[model samples]
Target: MTDDVPAQSLMLPVLLRPVISDLEKTDVAAAQTLRAALVKVENVHPGFTHDLVLGLVKKADLSINMNEALLRLQGQVADTDSEYRLRRAEEPFQELNRRSSLLKKILSRIPDEITDRRAFLDTIKEIASAIKKLLDVVNEIAGYIPGSTGKQALEQRKRDFVRYSKKFSTTLKEYFREGQPSAVFASALYLIHQTNLMIVTIKNKCE
Candidate 1:
């Protein structure tokens, strides 16, 4: 749960292969179309996977906002439970938790697959921004609690970032060849190092 926690080694779902096979069997043309689109995107943007993750983050944000609105409406109509646990035990939190879990799973796939420098740096930037937004959403959700029940989770997010940032640093190192910072790859390397440092700083500042 903490930011410094090591990455979980998750196997790709067994159903994924069967599901894709079923899709190919059921609608070959649609499956081909999907494949073509993915290939095109991969050709154009090597970092397309990162973009996909960012899109998921946006979706999560929308879900959170809708949940907030619903809670507000519920509040206006009738005063609900006083305890945070009771509220968190509801549908909205469950949905948010699901989204968060999915987002993390997708993100965990990126480092191993994307090796290009430009794509890697771009992915790192997007991930940093997305994670910041996610933590903010966490805080907002916690605000619904009467006390500080949410503090641990928020702190854990910070520590998780620390671990993720270290992972980024390691992955970036793989693509970096010996060169002056004047070159594009070197410049990217410098920027990535800075970004990792910034993540460390942000994590340290979290209470």
Candidate 2:
């Protein structure tokens, strides 16, 4: 049994080179193309929904760190009339901080379930709800901008921004739902479709 095992191990290399060299050459280019294609696929899919969630969390942090601090200081210096506004700002900051922490952790775990299209789509919807809440907080802030014209414009822009983001979020969700990138990844991948063109251009320059 020991002699048979040694003889079998020695024969392993005999069938490898001719088979491996041709296979490796073909696969290497394919792998490169797939890698490049994935980048294109990711970009065309637009701003990742996961990033938007993190972005809102960051925005919430800014509101807590900067705006809330300013409001508290302003309240201390103001007449009693403005105390309510300071309280309002402080309340939302606290609530948003809680929401943001939950969201940050949720975002961290997303890459694992991202391959499941249904879950990925659901996450898009969930993040959109969170975004809507963020925009609502912004709208509340806009109402207190201290001047008639500026406050009106701020409110207008807030509405427009919300509308724009909703459309973008929907488009990204649709792109993932269609599952085109996964299909493309499974196929050729096309990491660098212009590789030959680039090589030829480089050769011409050298010549």
Candidate 3:
């Protein structure tokens, strides 16, 4: 019983960012509603937090792809409103975005059922898989654009994913099994943020 108690006592570190508190104190009054909603949930579930952060990462990626697709249509279509083959390329991002939203909703509903470390890690795998799929989709989309720069940008993002994938694997081995959930989660969070910033830079180049 004592041994079981020690295992049960293991807790995820309180490394969660002060997201709600910071929002309340800052001049970002526009986000007050979101802040309020978050505060209402006294104990923010880790799984929910994972989904939210991952959702934003996925959204940023899709936005980058959408922006690139629009750029591909540039000069191809008579105007933004005109029909073009490149415009159809945006359908995949739309589908991906819809899937991200659905994932968030489903995860939010299942947090109570996934507090086990193994289960949470499995969800992390899902997030990683989703990011990989997005990377592949971006590459496929770039194929139809047909430009050296476009191909180069996609290749760069692919390289970034590979780096992050390695980092994630290393962190998972070093921290997750050592009972350090915060380290593993933080590594994933940082990777997503970094990748999103990279994608944003690529999107800006499309302009």
Per-residue CA lDDT of model 2 for 55-116, tens digit only, reads 66597775332212221222122222111112233555334333333332333334444578
Residues 87-197, model 1: lDDT tens digits: 245544544444343334334334333555577567667656655554555555554434343455445655654565555455456546642212222222222223233
Compared with the true structure, model 1 gives a TM-score of: 0.34
> What tens digits encode model 3's per-residue C-alpha lDDT throughout 45-90?
4245434544675977743322122222221221221111122436
Error of 1 at 10 (Å): 4.1
Candidate 1 ranges beyond 4 A from true positions: 1-102, 105-113, 149-153, 156-207
Task: Give RMSD (Å) of candidate 1 vs. truth.
Answer: 17.6
In order, what lDDT does every prediction score?
0.39, 0.37, 0.43
Which candidate gets the maximum lDDT versus the true structure? 3
Which candidate, 2 or 3, has the higher TM-score?
A: 3
Shift of residue 57 alpha carbon in model 3, Å = 25
- Look at candidate 2 and give me any clashing residue pairs: 33-190, 33-191, 34-189, 34-191, 36-191, 37-191
